[model samples]
Target chain A: MEATLGIEGGATKTTWVVLDAEGRVQATGRIGPGNVSLLREEELRALLAAIRTETGGQFHSIGAAFAGCHLAAQRERIAGLLRVFWPSAKRVVVAEDAHSAFAGAFGSGEGIVVIAGTGSNVRGYREGRWARAGGWGHILGDPGSAYDLAHIALQRVYDAFDATEGLVPLGESFLERTGQKDLEELFVYIHSDPSKDRIAALAPCVLESAAAGDRFAVDVVLSRCGLLADQVKCVAEKLRFDRPKVALVGGLFEHSEAYALLFEEQVRSRLAVSTVFVSRVPGAVGAARLADEAAEEHPGVEPKPSRILLRESATSLDGALTEERNPRSRFLDRKSVPELVELFLAEERLVEEALRERKEEIAAADRKSSYAVFCLKKK
Target chain B: MEATLGIEGGATKTTWVVLDAEGRVQATGRIGPGNVSLLREEELRALLAAIRTETGGQFHSIGAAFAGCHLAAQRERIAGLLRVFWPSAKRVVVAEDAHSAFAGAFGSGEGIVVIAGTGSNVRGYREGRWARAGGWGHILGDPGSAYDLAHIALQRVYDAFDATEGLVPLGESFLERTGQKDLEELFVYIHSDPSKDRIAALAPCVLESAAAGDRFAVDVVLSRCGLLADQVKCVAEKLRFDRPKVALVGGLFEHSEAYALLFEEQVRSRLAVSTVFVSRVPGAVGAARLADEAAEEHPGVEPKPSRILLRESATSLDGALTEERNPRSRFLDRKSVPELVELFLAEERLVEEALRERKEEIAAADRKSSYAVFCLKKK
Candidate 1:
């Protein structure tokens, strides 16, 4: 039985599935995360090796979908890994996890995929055209992102600080999670961190509270869900996705059934979404399906990531941290040039610290490169 | 014939008034910007010199309130300049324009003063204590600020780009003001700018559109006014004020009667405000009035800005531009470390460019400092 291996990669969880040449389910497989950027090459290879060991089978072709695998270099790196494990395989396909999720929902068709994990994004496809909304980021506007909810919750806590001595339920959750006694320490803890994952990780805390019937938490969750739904509707409207077959992916949809229900309610209420599914099929299966199609079209000739069926991102995804609102410089628009300089100088410390933390790695690489140069000179 | 020189310095405009020993209106004086951060000492002196020529009289004291004049060092610098001009003055008082604005509105009494200039801030005083809301900054939450209005408009334009070919009224205003043909150029131009004044400068455009009944513009302005109004109410409730006397200040109130009315309406509808008035008397007059009270209490002794009637800010006011949301890094929370480093590196270019633009002045300062060291050594 000729089999095609398929994998769906995401930040929250990753899964794999296999399909026969006739597109029937073949074998179940297990793998680690599919988000390419989150793993080192060695780590990814080790995790991926589990599938080969578990199935003990040769694949005719392998299709892998991983989150953040957008750049050609990233796709090539992932493809190289696939080739290494399945050296005898005639064809391998590597693509974005979003594309795979879309395929999983509506195979070889068009629809919208909205993922509200730690972050949030909405992508719609119709008639070979793509329309995107949200995903600008937490600062610019993540809309329904976990970071966004956390920000509002934090802001609310700070606001309530002057109004009352007691902590609100949301604030209490933050304090309990952070193991801090007071709001001041909580404020410092949150502001001191360089990454948002710590803040975003509290989304479940908020959701759990909401599910437990906290008015504020419930309101925040519902409103945030609406904001996310608005993105889906906006994307659908742009792509003219009438009766859109929408696939909800990522943390918010999977972690809390209540949250998923609320989000679905928000979406169904706002937009005429048809076949709104929680995407039980992992992206790996979708990727395998896509791979099967690609193998049929190319007849075993090697195809670059660009040749994959799903649309390549046309928008500038150079998307960076510089676009983020620095919490320290929130009032910058009100500052004069001299004050602006002072603020910029303070921000420089953080950037320098970011580099300083990577000093040993940078130094080690420099030494290796220098020794390489010495060897070349000796040669 | 003893007199006091009072000046109110603001970003929008600076005004000055004179009062006699008996607190009656005296010979008026003319001066330039009262924003201490915006002017060099020489520039300020030259501008303050206008008052000297215009009034041509000595004074018993001088009370000048300048915007952004908060630091102890900043107050001392301004006081030094005042001493040079008012040689024999028994009293000199330098204060924040907000303090003066509050004083101007209620004299020695208590009330809330809300300023919605290029930036927005609300400060309320009751008894001996003070309460404040908003004015965190554009990124943090300036509430009803021009920057807030402008951000919404720009976001609207970007959202509309995928939906329609025609420019919305707000977009039209942005393009017309920037002298750009389409949204692409406008987007590029905005993203390229180092400062936010370019974006904030478009507030009037949004306001004008709102005034002319542009649906999006009207909804945005009204909603923003409500946000700002909420701040005023928050401050009032914190202090437990009944029939609070609220005074509206800043460019939004002064530039557009339509906007001022809308804001007042929002405030009135939300809270039981006994009175709401646009502050016609500039902050400088209020500073002078406070100076008069100080002279009476201390018997002609010079009081530091700290000793003045208004409460010193208890919160961390070491505000900076780093707190701002960098437009380029809008999606940073979603990025990985490698991508984050890339974003940070790109942001460094902007900071480097900022320093490069001032390189000539920096070099000159370095040369001067080196020469000073050489001269000291020779001595």
Candidate 2:
């Protein structure tokens, strides 16, 4: 009667499934978004409580894959949250949405996974080493996402409104679909809402326009596909794989055969990947499979009690904020010589404190270290 | 008795020259950094006073080109500052540093100017139209600048420290030049100082290593030069030039002949340019030439009095701060149906007020419009 629980949590929705020892589905439930960064603590707790109510019975193991679980700290936080609801579960595994997608596509194997749903990211995993590129969200990169495709179409619309040339059929269709009377209203709608999903919704117009032979739209599609292919090539090079195996996931490829074919053709032309497959398996199933493996590895072992405690300090994610706030050393340029000297002294004191904290480790290493080893290390 | 004055002000230094009606140099003065954005009012006033002391003579016309004179408002502010120092001058012309560089290289003609001093920017001027790219400052862009080159070299050094592979000769050179024994000391030095100029000073090591045929260094140089060439191409495309005329400026080009040649080769390979020149003419001389042209055109006509007053209001720069402070519209996501409706109504009120302000202009345009024009416009 021992079973496993699996969950796939994303920006739009969350899905949970319970499976028996033989992998037969026992129960299933669907709920709202479960992205921890996007949800309040109370909302997350309530969602988990509802899931607990629906599942009804205890499980041998539980696994969850979530969006916004890219950082190690995020994974740890989600693991802590899960342990509260499933205290008796023998094993709990938490991972990024991409990792689950990859596992679902190719179980325990080496491959590249590209997810081009609302956003796009290309990740390659081979023999426990991973390489990734072009997942910098909407503002920074995201070259081949629905949002990117729609953004290109909108840029053309704006251009057509401003200039005499470069008009496309998609501009008219977009206006009609949105009930925007003119470019000015379209501008207002775009600026006022500023939502990624709302923007991505316009991607269909681009595809339709391209299918109907709009040159501008066709160019956008081709160029964006080329850019995605470049991302694949970049990942392959970084991973140094002899022949990459790639799996494509997400809504864009599933819905549009034309886009999928175009993307595949471009990628094949650029990279010598051995295989590329489009997977329809839900990431939740992959989570369940992973739980089964973990359970079999550590059979009948009790879960650790200390796993429930959350790590308090904010980690390396805050490094980006620090860099942003102080981009350059221009502040030092304005300070007088004396002030700069004082600042340097203060910084040196911090270094001294850090050294003091590591004094024991340093002394132990010094006692054990040899001159030959030090020279070898230097070389 | 009538002399024309010209000044070229940059991030590193400022140069001023006094010339007679026949373009003979009367007096010249050089001083420290003159970027108005980087200087306080009192500092700028003192610098101007020092310049006045050096060139102690009346001038009929004065033209000043300054860094940070990107916006029309910035130009106006610089002009106001100039008027305070030279009240009796017939005319005071203030422009961006790039414009002066262009004028210096190609007087009143169409050409692209690429500057790679402390920062990097590509500017194309054709007739009265101007197009620019890649001057997003140190944090965002500035891809081919000295700071950018140094930053790339520093990243490689850190990478080598962390991993066994990817070590290059430039890392040792950089460590030696910075007087840092290890990565920890380098980290402290970089964090404590944080100055663009200090970082940029390391660029010479990259160039030297590149010249010495270090594979990693060569790759960095080639890639960066290619990026700069891309910027040049982008500006040319935006300006829609048939055969671009280009001039290279800035300290990097002046000091590094090998780098200049490599950059030129890359740009020429990618773009069909009619002419490419590396000019040694100072920007101040260009400003002087511009003043000479202005004085000839206006003769003894007095400058407009209203031009002395600086614009007081801070405009769209505040918009960026607002966007950063409230990145998401999740505030709207949390509101109930009635609250959301109230928010929408409030937003509509603001829109209505904007429409009210522009009502007269809209009506004026409406009277001169036709159905055919409207449909054509819509199409």
Docking class for candidate 2: incorrect
* DockQ for each model: 0.04, 0.02
**DockQ metric, candidate 1:** 0.04
lDDT of 1 by residue, A102-177 (tens): 6655565677888777777787778767677755444335666787777666666666654464578888888899
- TM-score, cand. 1: 0.53
- Model 2 iRMS (Å) reads 10.7
Per-residue lDDT of B125-187 in model 2, one digit per residue for the tens? 775677776664554356778988887677656544333434357877877999986554555
lDDT of each: 0.63, 0.63
The value of fnat for model 2 is: 0.00
Give candidate 2's root-mean-square deviation (CA, Å): 25.0
**Local accuracy of candidate 2 as per-residue lDDT tens digits, A70-127:** 5555566666777788778777777667766665666656678888887887877776
By TM-score, who's the top model here?
1
